[model samples]
Target chain A: MTPRIAIQEESFDLAAETARLTAGRQDVGGLASFVGLCRADDGLAAMVLEHYPGMTERAIARIAGDATGRWPLLGLTVIHRVGRLEPGAPIVLVLTASAHRAAALESCAFLIDWLKTGAPFWKREEFEGGAERWVEAKAADDAAAARWTPA
Target chain B: MRVLYFAWVRQRVGMAEEEISPPPEVRDVAGLVDWLSGRSDGHAAAFANRKTIRAAVNQDFAGPDHPVAAGDEVAFFPPVTGG
Candidate 1:
């Protein structure tokens, strides 16, 4: 089955999204998920996501394509939300279905790793007391992606 | 020249996009920024810090030295904060 790659600004329902990803697939043995939520403690009271119209879609699709090619994955879905969002909301959702748990788990992790480092979307966060700032690239994200490189 | 602003940049500039001709003295990204900063109070405030803004020329990421020509599309926005 073809995978789904979307970058949107709307809020998403997790249960509904899971059902859609596993539809019509009896051969699916394992499903792995990774959800990223906006947090209040992290000073991210609100987030504004900005992305290039064409480049955002192409970059996300390429990552999903690469994930599918690297594993024996039968189905996958990627959902990323843009625009303004409140705290504790899901920012991204990645699902993978495969013949075994290891592949599904690995692909799920890989998807997030690649997304953090490769995707072209940018975020501006609002903090308490009316402060705001653009987030810088984290060194941790780079280190996570580096582990997946072939020796 | 068409100057496009996105996201917070749009909010600060109080404009989505606009078409204009660069001043004779405005030659590159940096010079164009200086010119835009003089447009209005909001423009000045948005361009105030200077360090927070970034520019893209013709959909490609560009630096301050990037050249600007007549009829070129220039986009300005804040530094990328995505993941």
Candidate 2:
């Protein structure tokens, strides 16, 4: 199987990733995917993603593993790109495969939500005229993650 | 121990990583932050708002009271913004 979790500087091919998980596999009934892109918001020139090397991989793996445990996942892939990236570049990709749509879809959402709060990656946006600032964590993102918590 | 900084913390602290020996009284993440803040103005500024910072000891998320010792890889960074 293609690696279930990945953190690298190079971009990912969504089609290729999807094919890898589904190819020659009748067991997979559904596959859900989410791709995050770098937007040119507020005249931003580019952004750089920074992460803790060993910690980032482990953090994401833990999140993926949680999804695997909670849902019946047949296959999963999480690719997050580091280093400098221009606007319109892809930032992250999440793919969750399962025997049904609900498990595939919900687990995909859960993985991304938890990744937002629990993962160690950070983005530094470089705006026009050489000014740059670290992207602030959104309260809404925290709220989004919180909704997934089991009571 | 090797301390690492990322994102704004790295920029403010003016270095990516460093080796430091805190006094024996410093036993956890919070204590280490307090001791590090005394090292320089930049260090103080980087850790000025403890609420905005997060810590990891030996690559695992660590709370303020999380035990730490020598030969650990501790990292401090702002709240994660990645998806």
Interface RMSD of each: 2.7, 0.6
- Give candidate 1's TM-score: 0.71
* Residue A21 miss distance in model 2 (angstroms): 0.3
- Which residue ranges in model 2 land beyond 4 Å of their true spot? A1-3
Query: For model 2, which pairs clash?
Result: none
Residue A40, model 1, lDDT: 78
Where does model 1 exceed 4 Å of error?
A: B1-80
TM-score of each: 0.71, 0.97
- In order, what lDDT does every prediction score? 0.82, 0.93
Q: What is the C-alpha lDDT profile of model 1 across A7-28, one tens digit per residue?
A: 8888777788778867777888
RMSD of 1: 4.2
Candidate 2 docking band: high
Which ten residues in a row are the worst by lDDT in model 2 chain B? B5-14
Candidate 1 CAPRI assessment class: acceptable
- DockQ of each model against the real complex? 0.33, 0.90
